[model samples]
Target: MRNRAPRSRPLRAVFAALTLVAGTMFGLAVSAPAHALGNGLALTPQMGWNDWNAFGCNVSEALVKQTADIIVSSGMKDAGYQYVNIDDCWMTGSRDGGGNLVPDPAKFPDGISGTAAYVHGKGLKLGIYESAGTATCAGYPGSLNHEQADANSFAAWGVDYLKYDNCNNQGISAQTRYTAMRNALANTGRPIVYSLCNWGQESVWTWGAGVGNSWRTTGDISANYTSMLSIFHSNVSLAQYAGPGGWNDPDMLEVGNGMSFTEDRSELSLWAEMAAPLISGTDLRSATPATLSLYTNKDVVAVDQDSLGKQGTEIASAGGADVLAKPLANGDVAVVLFNENASAQTISTTASAIGISSASSYTLNNLWSHVLTSTTGTISASVPGHGSVMYRVSHGSGSSTGTTHPLIGASSNRCLDVSNGSTTPGTQLEIWDCNGGSNQAYTLTAAGELRTLNGTLCLDANGQGTTAGTKVITWNCNGQSNQKWNVNPDGSISGAQSGLCLDVTGGNVPAGNVNGTLIELWGCNGGANQQWRLG
Candidate 1:
């Protein structure tokens, strides 16, 4: 926890100072939190349902009421799912005569207050969505300059949560815009949980703790394993920032939308392991028993709602097999053995290696199977393809082992090399002859970073650039998204920040694709220049 000074100073001044110091002294784009939002909410990651992924702009009061009814009948409410959030398109395109946001009468015949009353009567809270821009993402009236008026309308409607989005902002800073809404919500004197949805740009997590109960750490998640895996790789590295009051929101859960049952289970397990918000984005009315089982598993949910409030970190990752461990309040660690491959594989880890104190024996409680077993130290399981095996290990310690290998260009058969073997930040990366040198040995870290030179520096996108021609350089590993990479199955290495592939400069042409060619970020084509093999 960071220490705070007197509140006599302005907040923007404080935000600027902290951002500067964090960048200059630590090489980090975000400053550590002085404290999370003091609203006394979101002590645990928020678990609920949001209508966006499944319904989109089709949200209506009837849909929310039906969802709420099903949630209660399906035993989800008793299982700790509380909020029924209505996403965008709930309000009119224009504000009312009094400059207040108006609920679409066609959609909400009884108005928002009536909808909130109906929801509250069912023992669940109501959540609404708005944007901090000139217009909402759907082109509806936004709260950019009418923060107080919009916030007042939400509160007057008895809203308990607000999902503030990012769209159509006319060149304002995220912090300034979000802070204005935070202040407006506070002035309403309502205990509304604030969620910042800025699509993860601007390093929101660094300053998110002081501004909102939760901040998005990535773009919207789709209902597919690839999208979920990419988002997970990006979010798992920033475990140090989440706590009771604020969390790293990786968008919403995509379970029951379209993915297979195995993938759905993996999504739930990983999200719970990371202590992320479990806002369901599926239409619950037609949910299957398997989907409900994955959502209502008390033991798995326990790990997410644990009072420890610690986000899990990757303990071991290699060859598409990864392990994550979250320390629970009861002195047990929740371990997830995930397989990202297309075939079944056995994953293993030791109790002592996961941070548990030495013990005579340890108990492994399988969260999905509800089976209890004893292990002296070794914890292992057979996980199916695109699936996960989670366990609660009592008395354990963990270790991380990253594989160091040369990334060989698939076309030229040359190695990805650090220029002149320099360890300095901003040193260019290139392709060289396949020589077994330390400069050519890159370690893929649990944080999704490619680190070389004994893990001191990372492969970074030049100046956080997202363009096609951004230079790929070596810089100190600072836990920023620009340093994260997704080594995809098709042999393409794409940056988490830009979604651009790492390419060997001029590799498309045989003449310029030779040794000593510099590397860069480019559009992901199936060409050999963008393809790589790690060995």
Candidate 2:
């Protein structure tokens, strides 16, 4: 998420300093809270329904009531699904005489208070939306200048949750915008769960816990598995930021929203594996029983809601198949073996791979099957193509398991050469001095696109250029063969653009002089000159 544009004037010197001190004090208080709302505000991987995906900007009080009814009638509420959140566009064009926010009279004739009353009567918590910026993402009036008024209004309306977004005000720093809302909520004395929606801008994970109950760490999630996986994997490194009173939200769940379920289990398993907020974006009123079953799986929910509050990380992958390993509070490890390939593929992992080795014995509880099996020191299973097998591995002796970084090649010595650094999308590709900057950080998206850390496009040769010295530059992503670059275990990147590896042009040796050196496609010769590490 980008930062909003600054609209308000700067604060006075003393007021600014006091505000900073207040913020620090607030951070300390929240971090060391004696109690969080009720036993901590962290959602064991928040499982609820959000209206954004299905309803978009057309949310209404009747719609929320209807959704709440469906949630209870469909048995999802009984399955530990609690929140019925209204995403965006729930506000009217104007505020009331008392300076309180009013719901859209046409869509929410009973107003927000009535809507909240109805939702509360249904035995469900109510959540609403606002923008930290001047305008909401959906163009509705935001709470940018009306933080206290809106917060008080929400408290009066019995709101239990608030999804505050960062939309139009692009000039304000995320900390300032988030802090304003936090202060407003605190002053209101309402126990509203504050959700900071900054799209991961400005290192939100670094400070989100001090400001909000949950924070979005990625862009909006699509219904497809690839999109969902991309968002989930993007935040793997920030997992440690999540704890008892805060969570890293990877957007909402897309199950049953007309996406393929061939490996829907893999998606759900990965979400649970990451301990991500699991706000369902599907229509509960018309969802299939199978979908409901997926949502109501208690075993998976247990993994997500683990009291330890530890998020999972990727263990390994082959081709498109990958494994994610998460450590539970109970000294058990949750492993999700996923095959994201279009065709069937076998995936297997031993307990040793996830840093678990014992006296030749272990117990595996398959979360989907809700069954248990005893296996030797090595635990291996055949994961179907586009599917996954989620297991909770417990030690036979009930001893605590040690955790190593689960990702393969995570701690490897590799350098990513960003020869031409620019904020622009497409620039000439070249080898440069490695300084471990944002320009050097590359992310292999779940959609198979090699993107810069700031979400810029990574380009390939317009045509297959197998010959050496093929120039590379950024281009709009079309998922072409040339656009894909595979990072091998040895720190060499092979470009799909020409089926050739990225080579340091002419073996440039100097540090800063390598900045403008051209990048070329060459045959893999296993030369140290050609190997580039992703530092």
Give one digit per residue, the lDDT tens place, for model 2 in 1-535: 2223233311232243344347567774322222232424655656688888877877888789999999898778887778889888777776678866778889889887888889889899998888887677767677887899889888988998888887887577888988898888888877888888877666677687778887887767787777876776566656667876788788888888866544455677888888887888887877754466567777888888898888887778668778788888888899887777666556777888876645567887766643345777665665545567788898873211121111111111123444445766456565544455666656665554566535566656635566776766666677878788765433356775565776656542323223455566778554334444322
Q: For model 2, where is the 10-residue window of minimal lDDT?
A: 403-412
**Residue 184 in candidate 1 has what lDDT?**
96
Best by TM-score: 1
Which regions of candidate 2 are displaced past 4 Å? 1-39, 397-535
Q: Per-residue lDDT for 440 in model 1? A: 94
> Which stretch of 10 consecutive residues in model 1 shows the poorest summed lDDT?
1-10
Give the Cα RMSD of candidate 1. Answer: 18.9
Q: Write the per-residue lDDT of candidate 1 for residues 61-94, one digit (tens) a residue.
A: 9999999999999888988899999988898888
What lDDT score is found at residue 135 in candidate 2? 75
